[model samples]
Target: MLLPRPLLVLDLDETPWHGELGEATQVTFALRPHLGFFLQAVAQAYDLAVWTAAGNDWLQAGLQAIKHETGVDLAAQAVFLWDRGRCTWRRDEAGALHFRKPARKFRARWLRARYPRERILAVDDLAANYACGYGHLVRVTPWTGAPDDTERLDLARYLLQIAPVPDLRALEKRGWRARL
Candidate 1:
């Protein structure tokens, strides 16, 4: 029997696209280089989902932009599109408010039935965002319109390489870039 595809949770800002506030009512978005290819390639092996700290509006707008530019309908393809409301808020050492994606949420009956902790992975540029779930994180460098950025390209390869592993959480991922 074939195993179910693993779940891949993605972070939006800095990971896939960088948005700059253009005007009082505008936000210009620049997608990371090779994002389209990355998404399409990974989708072949993993079930994609989104979990961003941004508000629902921002998440929706970004997803729309991605679809418009890449022709990949992330919203329609994603198993879940989680926004800030789903995150846990916490204050940092300097007392600055930030949100975290608690990995424990994967234990929810609905989620667990589909994906166990070992069959899940999350990609993010900020390690703090997954502070409570380092084991599930595949850290990528923060992208800010860098034309030469190849993070997504490398990440796509890395994720596919390890997608067949039985226990993804047990594998050390901090040096994922170096692995490629």
Candidate 2:
């Protein structure tokens, strides 16, 4: 019997798209270059999910924009679309407020049944977001409307290359771009 595909948990804001909060609560979204192609390529190797520190409204609006613009219905395809409610509130030594996506949550019975810790990976622009689960992180440079950015394209190649690894979390993902 074939084993289950690994889980690829993705971050939303500043990772896949950049959102500008316009007047009257409108949000203008700029998608990363080659986002659609990246998603299509990665989906072949893993089950996708969205985990964002943004609130529900922002998440929904961004998803709508992503669907309308890129023709990729990310929400529909994602196993789960998690928002700020799922994040842990944190304060740094400077007392600055932050929201962290605690990796320990993966130990929950429901999630572990489908994806063991070693079979899971998370892509995020902020390394701090995965402080509790550093082993699972595949850090990407933060995106903010760089028209020439090829991060996602290169990232797709990297992810595809690593998909067959038995324990994704055990792999050293730093300098992954250089590897590709």
Candidate 3:
């Protein structure tokens, strides 16, 4: 029998859309209608979880809209929308707020037992958040809602290439292309 696919934990905010949460307008977000399509494509081959530092209330409407557009209900795919409350916060060397690590949260769940570190991947714009993930992290460029940003498409192709790898942690950073 074939084993299950790996778990893919994705970050929101600058990774998917552009602009700060408080300053964002509808137009400021990237991938709008296209976001759902991408999610659906990924979900077909991997278990997905959206790990974001944004507030739950602010993300809800956008998620719902994506669901409506693609018929790919995130919840239906067992995708968890983990918000800021689920993150581990710490002060950076520069004394700025840093809320990106998901290690603590994973340690508190059944996931810790179910998925091996090698079979898990976390994609984020900031390397600090998934620092604890070690070889499991994929750092993407921060999306600024630019018309030329092709990170999403490149990411989709990268995931497809690595989806069946027995140990994702063994993959090198150079193996994955973030932007076209």
Candidate 4:
């Protein structure tokens, strides 16, 4: 069976931007410079989305600048945007609710209701709390604007390797039928 286009939801803080959540005042370099190239590559196959805790204005402004500065058109593939929710801090440590992490579940409910066949792959640095029940879920290490392609490529390749594939053979066998 064929699979629906996968959703690649990325975090803006340390994953894409350099650090500090892409503030308007700070416009230096990105945490992952190769993010531009990686996003472009994935754009060919996946639907992109921005899921961060940042407000809309800040999110749009920073993303706009990134595209203008890098000429990567990072927002082109973005199909949706979701800023994480605030949780109650009354509970204890773990239970205190770090709902700030952008999760697939935030959009998963509607996604399922609308398009159940499609899946969401969450790309984040901080630990995530959302589970959208998409094809898969991914997590990248949180960075502080280091600007490296090696790590970015590794992560991107990992995403491609795991996402949009069917059955264990598509993963473990790593050959033959995958090309079909």
| Residue 129 in candidate 3, Cα distance off native in Å | 0.7
lDDT of the candidates, in the order given: 0.92, 0.91, 0.71, 0.58
Which 10 successive residues of model 4 have the least lDDT summed?
168-177
> What tens digits encode model 2's per-residue C-alpha lDDT throughout 1-180?
566689999999999999998898778999999998999899999999999999999999998988888788988999888999999987879999899999888898998999989989999999999989988999999988989999998999999999988888889998888888
After superposition, candidate 4 runs with Cα above 4 Å error: 20-31, 85-97, 101-110, 113-118, 131-136, 167-180
Candidate 1, 100-124: lDDT as tens digits:
8988888999999989888999999
Task: Identify the runs in model 1 with alpha carbons over 4 angstroms from their true place.
Answer: none
Q: CA shift at 84, candidate 3, in angstroms?
A: 0.7
User: In angstroms, how far off is 99's CA in candidate 2?
Assistant: 1.2
* TM-score of candidate 2 against the unseen true structure: 0.96
What is the per-residue lDDT of model 4 for residues 115-136, given as tens digits with 9 covering 90 to 100? 3433556666655433332223
Error of 3 at 153 (Å): 1.6
The TM-scores, one per candidate, come to 0.96, 0.96, 0.81, 0.69
Per-residue CA lDDT of candidate 3, range 1-180, in tens? 565578888887777665443444443344532565567677777898888887786566556655665676665565467888888788879999888666656665677666666778888888878777668788877776777766676787778778888888888865365422
